[model samples]
Target chain A: MAVRVQREAFDIGAEIDRLRAGRTSVGAVASFMGVMRDFNDGSGVQSMVLEHYPGMTERALESIVAEAGERWPLIDTLVVHRVGELRPSDPIVLVVTLSAHREAALAACAFIMDFLKTRAPFWKKERTPAGERWVEARASDDRAADRWQEGDGA
Target chain B: METAHGSVRVLYFARLREAFGTSGETMDLAPGLCTVADLRERLALRGGVWAEELAGSRVVRFAVNQTLCPPAHALSAGDEIAVFPPVTGG
Candidate 1:
């Protein structure tokens, strides 16, 4: 498992290939990438700045990935989140490479992203036409995290 | 004829500090406020801008001991409770 918080953009394909480098049991690889958008809550966003609680952010991601490990027969996992300023269409975050059987890889990939959306300790401030405003958590995100409580892989 | 007691220190970060104008503070909490929600009500009573910012059902985030926590999280003297707006960072 790998979790990195940096401003550098990540290459999903490269990371996935490295993860599977000598592993044969891995039959699947799944991933997700989150990018900065130009609109939020009906506001025309120009850019965004992300901030996090340093030590706490890494710990939170570690815990989330550990939970995924417990639920799936994952061979490897990676979570890369960016901080500082980013413009629209910039890759802000990436969770790539879950190795396992095809089914386990896909399910674990979705589960990691869903858990991160609600549990991660990062925040974004968007520069919009009005001004820089903090984005609020969506009800949809809350619901996404909620499903895991009942659907723990059994 | 009284012993000295330290005040409770509450930390603020992100939008909460920007709105409140103070990054952190140690305040002598009034008697009987011993949980996250209780502290919020007492702090909200500070009046003026604070009353407007923290008043009524506004969504705010809480962290106790560096972990995301709910308002129901219990507090004791000297515990570190951080208040901020909901996280949106990548």
Candidate 2:
């Protein structure tokens, strides 16, 4: 398992290749990439700033990946979350899960993302047409995270 | 016995930092001030923004020693406490 919280842009292809290297046992890789959108909540977003709790953020990501490991037969898991200023279309986060079967890889990928959405300490503030505003936590995100608690795998 | 006093490192993030105008501060806690809620009430003594931002209905989250915790969680001397708005990340 590997987790990175950085300001530098990440190359998704390179990261996947690194995980695939020397791993003939891996049959599936599931990945998710989150990008900054040009608009949100009826406003045009100019840019975004992500703030995190530094040490706590890394610990939280590690814990989330660890939880996924316990639930799935994951060969490898990687999470890369970017911090600081970013523009529209910029990659904001990435999650990659490798497993012998598609089911484990796919489920673990979604699980990691679901937990990370609400449990992580990162916060986003968008520079919109009106002014800069902190993005509020969506109710849908809470519901997404809550569903995992009701079941064993998902 | 003397009334005990201890200091905690309080951190503010996101909007809290923007409102408080500082990233963190060292607060001296009085004895018997145990839980996160107690500390918040004490901090609220500053009134105005402090009281308004930390109002009961506001969406605030707390972390004690870098771990997310509830308001009733006990606090300890030399602990690192963080106060921030609800997280919005993916």
lDDT of each: 0.81, 0.91
lDDT per residue, candidate 2, B3-76, as tens digits? 54688899999998999889999987777577899878887778888988985578788999988899899887
Candidate 2, superposed: residue stretches over 4 Å from native:
A152-154, B1-4
**Residue-wise C-alpha lDDT for candidate 2, range A10-61, written one tens digit per residue:** 9999999998899999999999999999999988999999999999999999
Worst 10 residues of 1 chain A by lDDT: A145-154
- Report the lDDT of model 1 for residue A10: 75
TM for chain B in all models? 0.84, 0.89
Winner by lDDT: 2
For all predictions, the C-alpha RMSD in Å is 2.9, 1.9
Best by DockQ: 2
Per residue, candidate 1 scores C-alpha lDDT tens digits across A25-113 of 87788888898888878779999888787777898899989998988888899999998889999988888655657888888888888
i-RMSD of all predictions: 1.4, 0.7
Q: DockQ numbers for every candidate?
A: 0.58, 0.82
